[model samples]
Target: MLLHMFFPSKCVTCGSFGKVLCVSCKNSIKPVTQDSCIVCYRNSINGQTHEICKKTSFIDNALAIIKYTGAGRDWIGVIKYKRAYSTISEVVSIFPQSWIQKFKKITQYYTNALIVPIPLHKQREKARGFNQSKKIAKEFSKITNIPTSCVLLRVINTPQQAKQPTKNTRKENIKGAFILKQGQVVKNKTIILIDDLYTSGCTAQEAAKILKIAGAKTVLLFTLAHGKV
Candidate 1:
């Protein structure tokens, strides 16, 4: 309370005084209404990978809360680069109630699910103070009561995907970037990979492939926002 009084929150968009994201700005940002296959970005039921797409993808299902545009993009940038961590919950709070319910149903269906944040290279994380994905995962677990795990390790310090110009380059850069931590058990469990944003999805894909190779029963991705393919 003292902290808030000293440094009051203000909307990242429109510069309103009060909340990190005001209700009006929150409502203006659109939510993803239709689920799409993560691999092909085509309409799919509950964001499941199309059976055909699954042959080439390791992630079984994926979901994102919003599109990466306008206010949505600004919101993510604030949380990511500006380190406005509180904005994460502010963003999630505005999600359509339907999306919240659907997410809960997914957790129920996958009873053996574990929320795993995409790991950051130790050097990067040390500089940033916290992993944005881990923060998002904590929010999800708080709502759903599922456990969170840091089972994946970033063994290679790769360039940020945003800097990679092409999808192929991004894929190549993230390849072999992650490995499961020694003695961590994901076998026969559903791994819910958490990330702040999804673009080419090379980062998530590489992490998911590692989980799948380790015998995870399924791999699902949940992100706060997604950029254009």
Candidate 2:
């Protein structure tokens, strides 16, 4: 707490002192107005997987609070690369109350639900000092009263999805990258997968596939930012 007082907080967007995100920049961040299918990225109700698209993907539905642009992108970058962990709370603070209520309502539909964050490889996570997705998932769970779990582990240290040249390559790279932890049971439970960003979605898809294979009833992904596909 003393550290925070010594170097207070400044708005990431406008450099204003006091708040991590000033009111003006917070209001300026655009929310995803249209829900889309997780598999095809086409129009869908509540970001659910289209019935026809279900055969190709494991995720049941996906949701994101903000588009990955401008201040939203900056906010994620700070938390992810700069280690500005406090920014996570500030970002969550600005989430529209309507969105929070909708998320809470969604959780009500499942009797047994678990919040799971996309896990990073051990080395990467150790070097970074924390898993950004896990941190985000904790905050998410706090708001919704859902429990969080780390049932999936990253066994492969593949190249980053952003560096992959094509979507197919991204998918191939992430294939078989995750495995269920020994003795961890996800059978018959709904999973809410949390992540910092959604770009190609190869990472989330691969993680969800493993959970489904382990008998998870449903896997709903919730990301903080949605990047262009």
Candidate 3:
């Protein structure tokens, strides 16, 4: 009773006063059980790239644990803006265990896999105190035992993709925004690109392009949620 009076629980999605996420609302955030084409954003079998959707220049597979909305979106907002570390942990704990298995299958080619979080500009990271993507990657790394390498760097700080008016503009914004760090070795390796959200697919495509050009065997993108369907 005392705890309830001091810190009342409320549903982040519907504002139902009782819990951070009510049971019904929690069920609304469904885990993605199907594979999706990273480029076309369509349902895929076993997360495989549809032959027609395959392209030489971009990423192969895109994996998201949940569709962006309801509790999933609210949880990501908490991690990104509020920097609530506990909430982040809570959110990740609920991630479908199958997600880890799916990701491992995606990168099975490389004996040594490296996880890379989408980098943030130094200035923006300093202002935010911590990189949310990096945080997510680290937590995920703990769960999967895949080591995270801070190999990717944001050489060009660009505007946030969400603020862009169109998907094309978002792609243009981050076209040349990322590069690998000095002495980074991605050759013949599969890289798991981690991020908080997937919006226009622009950022993932750009980052994957750079990695593939630099000799990465395959680049797979995994985001916590997918925005804009």
Candidate 4:
């Protein structure tokens, strides 16, 4: 295979041959499975389930590929800041496809969802030259054939959540931060909210709430990683 000749098929993090993520590193980024609450994906961290993630919640479901630290953190940082777009293919190829397939089995109610990337404000986008979420969504769409809608826009700029420390501050900071663009594309459509990471789950939750307000039938969140919250 000529393609195989040029690409060594080495692990992105460790430069080992045979796979994009060597089996050892892949095992390191495993998701926590200690009987977590389905809503917040938190495993009773506060001695009681958080009030926000009560059953029959606003946003339908949230799924993340790996816990965001170690190799996962390194990969996300490289992809976002170091222009390692090739790693996107490597990461996506190594994604837990079984987790996704199983989630679809449970959330069959949202059979015809459209993927929507949370948008960046125009100024920030211009500064960064591209939105990473948009790039992820584009690649996801290519692989899955799910339509991606830029129907939501961040009309106002806010302080970056990565810089903010407190969870409450993160939620408050993004309140009234995004707006549905002047288009009828999302109405009556089941929507999949895509993002690079899930910390505190505030951003994805807020985006899902906004899309629901805009008449999206359902909103599900998907992210590449979930950091400690």
Query: TM-scores for all candidates?
Result: 0.92, 0.91, 0.85, 0.77
lDDT of 4 by residue, 97-117 (tens): 765554455445566678889
Write candidate 3's Cα lDDT for 1-229 as tens digits.
8765334477667888876666676667767666677667678875556777775337777777777776677767756765455555666677666776765665565567888999999998998778888888887687667899989899988988888899788988998999888999898888889998887788988998889889998777878887663
Ten-residue segment with the worst summed lDDT in candidate 2?
Answer: 2-11
Top candidate, metric TM-score? 1
Which regions in candidate 2 have their CA more than 4 angstroms from the true location? Answer: 1-23
In candidate 1, stretches whose alpha carbon ends up further than 4 angstroms from where it belongs are: 1-10, 16-19
Count clashing residue pairs in model 4.
Answer: 0
Clashes of each: 0, 0, 0, 0
RMSD of each: 2.6, 2.6, 3.7, 5.6
Q: Pick the candidate with the highest lDDT.
A: 1
Q: lDDT of each model, Cα atoms only?
A: 0.89, 0.87, 0.77, 0.70
Clashes of 2: 0
Question: Where does model 3 exceed 4 Å of error?
Answer: 1-28, 105-109
- Candidate 2's TM-score: 0.91
